[model samples]
Structures are given as C-alpha cells and as structure tokens.
Target: MTFKLTPKQEAQVSLISSDATHIMAYGGSRSGKTFGFVRAVLIRALAHKSRHAMLRYRFNHIKASIVLDTLPKVMELCFPGVADNCKLDKTDWYYSLPNGSEIWFGGLDDKERTEKILGQEYATLYLNECSQIPYASRNMAITRLAQKTPLRLKAYYDCNPPGMAHWTYRLFVERRDPDRRTPVANPGNFAAIMMNPKDNEANLDPKYLEELQSMSESMRRRFWLGQFADVTDTALWTLELLDQQRIVDGELPDMVRIVVAVDPSGVSGEEDKRSDEVGIVVCGLGNDGRGYILEDLSGRMSPADWGKAVVSAFDRHEADCVVAEENFGGAMVQEIIRSASADSSRKVGGQVPYRPVRASRGKIARAEPIAALFDQQKVSLVGLFPEMEDQLCAMTTAGYVGSRSPDRADAMIWGLASLFPAMTKQNAGPNGARSPVVNLGYKSMKRKRA
Candidate 1:
C-alpha cells in the first residue's frame, strides 16, 4: 500500500518535521491526529536506533485505544510487512523493532508502569488523548525526553479539545505557560492545529457526521467542531478544584462505608431512547472521614439495564445498600429494583438492600452543600469522571446551565448526602434526630415502657 497523508495530516507532518519542540494535534473525535502522530513516531523509530514512548492518562485506555487498536491499524496499513519484523513486549508494553529502536506504551494513571517508562530516555514522546492527562504528570514525563539519538527530540500531543482552561489550550493556543500563566519563553516552540471530522470525512461514516450535527450546541462545539468549550463564570465547580482532589489510580484509602445512588431518567429499555441518562454513582466514606467517589455508571438505558448496572455496582463495590430517586415513579421504581434484584446473577442471600429517596428541593439547592464539601477539599475522586465533571461544572447558583441534564451530578450529590447525614440534616425529624429505616422483623419486646 502506498503511504498517503490527508491534507490535515500533511499539515501535522510538516509541523512535526519542523524544529518545534512540542506539537499538538487537537480537534474533534475520529480525526486523523492519532494515526498521523503514531505513524510519524514509527517512522522515526525505524529510521534509527532511537527510543519512543506512547502515553495516555490511563494504562488500560492507551492499551485498548492505541497499543491494541490504532498502532496495529497504522502498522498494517501504512508500514505493511514491517510489523512482522517487530517483537512486541507484552510484559512492559512496547514494541522492539528489527533494529535497536524501541517504542514504549504507558498510562500515567499507573504509578508502577510510569516509573518503569520514566527510567528510560526517549527520542520521542507522544501523549495520546492528552486532555485527560494532568499538567504535572506531563512535566514529569517531559524530563525523560533526553535520549542522545541522531533524531531531534520531540513530544507530540493530541486530544478531543477540552475546555479553554485546560493546559493544552493555554500552552498551544494561548501561547502561555500553563503553571505561571505567562508567556512562554519561546512561543515558536509550541504549535497546534485543529482537525475535525469534516477534515477526515473520507475515513468516517456519513451518518456519523449527521449524528454530530444532531448533538446539543455545546456538545457539537467540542466533539464535532473541535472548539474549546468555555468554563462558565457562575459554575460552582472548576476544573482546577477537581484536579486538586483527584486521587491517582490504586491509591484509595480504606473504605468504612460504601453506597450506590441511582437517579433513573424515565428511560425503560428501547421504549424511550431520548430520555435523560440514568445517573449511577458509587461513593465511599473512608476511615479518614473523607469521601471518595468510586465510579460513575450513568447512561441512557432501560429499567432492566440500569437496574442491572446498579446491582452490579452494589456487588462489585460491596456497598451497604442501593439508594434510588423515587420521585420519578415511586411504585414503579421500587418494582424495578425488586425485579432487578430477583434477576441479579451475584446470588445475594435474598435481595440487595434497596432504599428510596425523595427529592424535596431543586438541584441547585441540593448541590450547594455538596459543592461546599468540594470547596473544603474533603472529597476526592478516585479517577477522572469527564462527563460527571462536565455536568458539575455546568451547575451554578442560578440553575443547571449545561446543554445536557445534570443526572450524574444529582446521583453524586445523593451518594454524598447518604454517606454524610449531617449534610442533609433538614431531612431529619425535629431536634436534629434523623429518622432511621427500621427492619420490622426483629422486634419481640417493645421499648420496656419508656
């Protein structure tokens, strides 16, 4: 096969071949940035006995998205039989060419693997899906781009552009140093170009473009048009605040109590595909008296599907109980839980414990207190929750301002409220004594005539 580059990819190749120290290829999803960038790295590796590293925010993500998917495609289509000459190291996650060159893949979320990759100097470093990576980790990896090879050392980055506040936007678009918030010493060293689905139409489905056009304005701007979404001035949560409290993978403290909260969006299977997403979030109360968010399983699913997801999260996390929003349809929601528990494959002794919660206040009224916990830095996210964080950042004092519904944020708030009863003291009875849910079967003698 002849190696060909689309105009967008050709632009990237020209920029990368230049003397620029950093190259950013960012834009909409399904663009050719990743393929072009990976092919360039392989070209360099095959040219000399140089070392290259391909990294993403998470090891599993990079493995699935690039190492397993894009890398193989690029090798087979463009490089052809050259892939057969390379030996893949599954243990350390890299490819060893017939020559002395090496290509390593890693996820910054994995501390152990990151240490191993950082030990080696690389002629080239490619940060894939860099929007999800923290600025601090990028700096840490940049220190290792010091291999003494014949090729000029370079670092490549690509992303489905995040908000304007992201480091990529500051460094590549604003030409400002991310940390210092000032002009970079050499502005010419940082270069970036946008590549949207429109530019890669030949490689995409016609229906895909229509799908992108059907999205909300904000969603279309970021994913389809490849524009940097803005952080609203009235948002209660900021990206920096979430990053400050983010706990790296494999570092969660001992959990004292865990609960799964669900907010069903009235979608029951294929019957209603246009309903809002079902918000499912698992939160744990650590022994240190702080909160740790375990997972976000929110999506648009039928009752059976969301119910299964809820029960699955319950069993996987070993949560005390599953709390769901009953305001949608009290009896129907309860029945769904009962049916889901009956059908659960985990084989619970009888049924997973179910609790129904009613929403007496509006979303902002409920989120204000939860946002305060974040403001106080008492809560930490176990990993990145991009969609959940988006909803949170769109919530403000006035209303839910985002294009999509804030169901994920609502579920998170409910989980936190359940874990910290003090956060919702208003729901209690008079004199601050919260009413407890009592199991009626244990009663033999009453309170002894107190």
Candidate 2:
C-alpha cells in the first residue's frame, strides 16, 4: 500500500527509525505529530514481534483519542486491511496484532490498571500527550523500558508544548535547569523535534490556518509557532504568590463562615451547543481573619448535573450559604440549585441558604480585589487545585488569555467577595464624597490607570 506522509511526519518517522533511545515530537495542534508517531510505533511493532505500550494521563482519554480515533486512522493509512485481523481486547485495552507483536494501552490514573499494564516488559513505549503526565509518573514508566528485544529499546513522547517550567521542556527542549534557565552540564540521550500547523498545511483546511493565526498571543505562540512563550508577566497571579499561600491539607483554622460559589454557564439548557464549565468553588473565612480556598468542584455539565454538584459541595462543606452569580441566568440558577437540593437523595432538613449576586462590573474588575487579597497574604489555599490554579495563573488585567472561560477564577472571586465585601465593593465617603484610596500595595491594583 502506497501512502503519502507530510514532511514533518516523515521527519518523525525517520527519528523513530533512528538509533535514538529517547525521542520526542512536540508541537502545535493538528500537526500530524501524533499520527506520524503512531504509524511509526505500529511499523516497529509489526516488524519486530515484541510487546509495546502506549500511555496517557487518563485511561478514558487514551481510549477516546487514540484507541477510537487515531489508531484506526493510522492502521487504515499505513497498513490497509491489517485492522481486520487486529484483535482488540476491550477489557485489557490492547491490540493483538496479526503478527506476534501486541500493543497495550493504559492510563496512569488507575493504579491497578497501570500496574497490570507495566507488569510485562516491552520493546518500545509511547507516551501520548505526555505533557499532561507528571514528571514523577513519566520517570516511573522510564524504569520499565528495559525490555529484552533485538529491536532498539526506545521511548516515543509527543505533546503540544506546555509552559517552560514543565519537565518536558527542561528534559528535552532546554536540557537545562528550569529555574535558572541554563543548559545542563550533562544532558541525556533525548531529542525533541518541533512542528507547527504550517508544517502540515497540505493536510489541514485553509480556514483552520486562519483560525490559528487569530488566536490570543500566548496561545498563538504555543500552538502556531510551537514555542514555549511565558505569559506570566501579563497574568495577575503568579506561581510564587500561590505557593507562598498554600497550606498543608487539613491545616485550616476554624471557619466563621463557609460559602459555596457558583458561576453558571450561559448555555445551561442548550445540550447541543458548547458551553462553559459550571464553576463551583468552596471557600471559608476563618476566625483568624484569613480566607481559605477549600475545594474546586468545577466541571462541564448540564444544568441538572452542575446544580447537584453545587448543592453537594454546600452540604459536604457545611457551608453557610450558596452564593451564585445571577448575571447569566438571573433567578434561574438559584432555582436550579434549590431544585437539585430538594430532589437529592441525601435529604437535609430545609432548603440551603441561597444568595444571588449580580455581576455589574467586568470579570477582571471583580477579580482584581480578590487577587489583591492573595497578595496581602490574607488568602491561602487549603490544598492544591491544579486546574483552578492554571486558570488563576492565566488571568490578566486585559482579561483571561486562556482559550476557555475563566470560570474557576470567577467562582473564587464570588466566594471571596461574599466573605470580604471590601474586596468587591467600591469604597466611598458616607455622604457620597470621592472614593478613598485604599492602598493595599497589590501590584495589580497599583498598575491600574487613574
């Protein structure tokens, strides 16, 4: 069977065919990197009768993206009719190839599944979308690459580059100290090949190229140019700021008031349309006068589902009230929460206290004071919330630069505002005089124009 490959894909294939033990193809979206690498791994597995494994951060993600989407496409393109004989064991999540070789796929999320998958040795290993996998887990998998086979003991990794602070960037791209941003004195046998959307232009739609070009600056840099461009300078929150305020789990003080804040998505009833996530965050104001972020229950769900989540968090945290933003749905959001609470199997005595707050100002305007509280060491996170922190770190005065809505941050703001009214309300004289300048010494507030 004759099949054409893009230049970038050919380069990736050549890398896989080379003597390199550790290889990475990192780049932009729809760059054919994943397809090329999958094809290369399949070819290797077919040529050499040995066990191979493909892994991702989540098992469902591996099944949805690779097993269901990419793997079949690759087999059809490279080895026509080979899938007819390929036996897929749904229970084990592996493909029994026509040849003696077997391709096993699993995720690191499930401990039992991971142990089962890694119990056997393999000739080759592929870590798909490896950027999402933590460095420690990746290191653990690297130890299992000692398969005894004539085929070269190689590992293939591919991802759209994350932040420069990511281990992938330190291990492959810079081969240096992530903190100091300096080259390593002794680097390992790793090679990183980067390819952008333009590299696979012939295989992509022209409209897609236009869309890519029009992305936000931070997104365009990472997705289009395949570069690790830092947007920390523009962001309101920094990792250092968050880290300084991070407390050990179960170290929270007595809470005077706890609130469950909800940021309802506009498309609550529209199942067909793509909607933003329902941001549900639990926060408490301790007796010590410090704000503590308790939990982040943010998710993309229907109105009924998210409503249940909000009430669940409220009961789980023993929250005093449920504070919801009414800008999008008016009273409908509160009604959803009340209905869900009333219908819940875990019946409480009475209806949970629900307070609806209207969003009159812009998101950034409301978020600025909440961020200032963090700067003043008045707020701390009870535990690490990676996804929520990611959104918080992406928020800028200009607005959130991330592709999706900053719903998590919005929930945090709502909760914080309820706990500390001064954070959201504008200061004024008793008789309507000029607003007093409250110098909180927050850099974000200081940088604002007069």
Candidate 3:
C-alpha cells in the first residue's frame, strides 16, 4: 500500500486519477512509465476488487523485454512477498494473484492469435509500446474491453513518439480536441494523455541525467529528449514530399495511365520457403494530377508464379505496362514470366517486355522519395496492407527484421516508374537510372535502437 512513486510516474498516476475513460502515459525510455502503471493496476484492482487485468506488448519482443525483465519487478514492488506464489507461466504469460484478480501478459505480434485473446472481458488493460500494434488492431482491442459487471473498466496506453500515421494515434493524440466542454463521442470512449520525459524529473536519477548528457546527439534525442527525429540532417526526402490529395473511396477518376511494378523472387511453393520475395505494386495517376499507390501483392514465389501474380494485377487494374529490375534475375526473369503467362493465354507483350533497372544506391536512397510522398499525403494506400506498412514504418538504417517486409516499397517504385515512365526517363542509362541524392532523416519517434 506504500510503494514509492517516481516523480514522472506520480504525474502520470495523478492524471489517470481523473474521470477520463482512457489515459495515455507516453514518453522517454527508463522513465518508469510501465512500472508506474503496474502499481496503478494493483491499486485499482485492490480498490474495486476487479476480476481481471491485462498487460500487453508487441508480440515478438514480449518475452525478453517486458515479461522477463520488467514484469517481475512490477509484481515484487506491488505484491511484495507474494512474488514466490505468483507463477510465471511461459505458455500463458500471466500471473495470478490471491485476490482473484489476475494479470495477463501478451503481445500483438501475431494478429490472429492476439485477436483470440481480445475476446476476453477485462477490467483494466495496460499496453506497452502501443505504437507497435497496427492502428486497426489497436482499435479492435480497445473496443473489445467491455464488461457487463460495471467493474469500473479502464484502459492504460503508454508509448513513445512519433506514433504511426495510423488512426489510433490520430484519434487519440494528433487530432485537436473537439470543444473541451463537449465530450467527443468516439468508438473506444477512452481518455488519452501525453507527457515529456522532463515532466518526470523526480523519477530520473542524477546519474542517468549525467549519462544522458554524455551520450551522442542521436542517443540524447532518442532517450532523454524524447523527440521524433532523424539521425542525419541531409535526407534524400524530407517530410515536404507528401502531396495532400484526398482519396475518395469508390470514386473512379479519369486521367493518366496506371502502371505495375514488380520485384519478383526466385522460389515457389505453398510454404514460405522462398529465398526472396516478389513484390508487385500497382500505382496510378489521378486526373487531379496526384500520385496514388493502389495495391500491394507481395510474397514468396518462383519467376513463373510471380508472373501470374503480375498478370493478375495487370488485369485487375488494367495497367498500361509493367516495369521490373533486371539486376537479380536478368532477362531470364522476363522469359520465365512470359512462359508462365503463356500458359494462361495471356502474353506479357511478346516475351515479357521488362524494363531493365539496376540498384546503384542503398535501400534508403530508393525509399526516401517514396516516404516523402507518404508524408506529403500525396500517396494514399487504397487498401490496408499491414505487412508492407509494418516494414516501411519499422525500417531503420541499421536494419529491420521483426516488423514487415520492404516488398511493398520495391513494388511502389516499380509501379510509379512504370505508370509515369517519363518521371525516371531523363536519368535512364544503359546501366541503370541515376537516382537523386536522398537525405536520410532520422526517426520522428522515440524507438529503442537495438
């Protein structure tokens, strides 16, 4: 009943004590955000005699970071001597308390599996690194936390900035409050709050402050400052590149042509045993003169299998042409695809007319321009492709493995170039096209750089 609170955590708890249905405590690393929330859960469950509580993290990282490292500390601090009786069940990832109020831990990595857990009713929900889960999943989870027992249900979401450009962040923090006096009716009906690391000065150790100061510029910004920033000042594409053209669903517009881009893999089968993937994207130009990223068809396949995928998109979107990079498989890529399409009575323009391209720059160089289009809102995703977006958002200069794939990014470039051939035509050479120098901007959100 008398656990000590960090200054930063005290501020967070004080804010949560309000009547808001949803509360968000987000900020820097080592700010005691998770620890504070754990204590808060104990207090709430004990006070109200709640039946169930939940704590979640991104799926892939739950075991090492949240469950193994932090969860026990939280249990010891709150329940004291009961830590021995409280079991750490690896299979279920939960700790049962004597009060009948149990705390469950989980990750949102696997969408299907996570969905099954969301079906359960709970009194309180604590989410760590809420940004890792897709906005759609987050939205789904928040709505599923309903109970008829009137057990004073509440949800706690803690994250670091810059949250994804998805709906969850938009609905909770980014959008302006609509008339403070009038409660904005929303699906979750949850209250949200945000705070900087500096706001929790009491919880931070003096040594931690000194270490933070001694760290490099990038480290300082990522941890202590809690800024959504890029590592480098000179980036290939700045945030200004996105074009603000709204996409009206179901509205077909007349105008420029549509092109398909393909990044094919050289493997085949029902299983994901392919060494690489074939990423096919369909991008179109609107009559209004803005770029539109239509669809993403990405996965493992042989050259012939990818050809069928390409033909499918080509027919579906009525693409004017298809462009592919010949660096990996060369002209054989064209032959194999044409051969496959031939089986289906469709020809890839007299032996698969593949536009040869080479990659002389890094992946970041190729992706910066596309990211600009997204930031400018010039490029809008027609449908949801969680795997592709996960790759794009989580991609770091170092590398990204736990998230999604860059197949979508590759397909986009191909699609854009194919649709608007003139865009990259000027730089075209026999060897390859010379991409412009791109600025590699650091992240706009605080992330634990491993």
- What is the lDDT, from 0 to 100, of the residue 156 in candidate 1? 97
- Which 10-residue window in model 2 sums to the lowest lDDT? 441-450
lDDT of 1 by residue, 328-444 (tens): 989888777777787655435667878788999999989988999988878988876768987888998889988868999999999988877677764586788875432222211
**Backbone Cα, N, C clashes tallied per candidate:** 1, 0, 23
Relative to the true structure, candidate 1 reaches a TM of 0.72
Model 3 lDDT, full chain set: 0.58
Is candidate 1 or 2 superior in lDDT?
1
Q: Write the per-residue lDDT of candidate 2 for residues 1-450, one digit (tens) a residue.
A: 477998888888777766668889888878988898788789888987889999987687788788889999999988899999999899888998988799999888679999998898888889987656777778778788888877889899987776666777787887876556788665656777998999999889999988777765655666788876464656778654664556642245667677899988865543634778888999988767888999999877778888888888876776677899988888788779878888544344556778888888888888888899988878988765666877887889888877788898899989888888755563334665544323322231012212
Q: Which one wins on lDDT?
A: 1
RMSD of 3: 16.3
For every model shown, what is its TM-score relative to the native structure? Answer: 0.72, 0.60, 0.49
| Candidate 2 runs further than 4 Å off | 177-188, 231-354, 357-391, 395-408, 411-450
Model 2 TM-score is 0.60
Q: State how far residue 426 of model 1 sits from its true place (Å).
A: 7.7
The candidate, 2 or 3, that scores higher on lDDT is 2
Residue 17 lDDT, candidate 2, scale 0-100: 69
Worst 10 residues of 3 by lDDT: 237-246
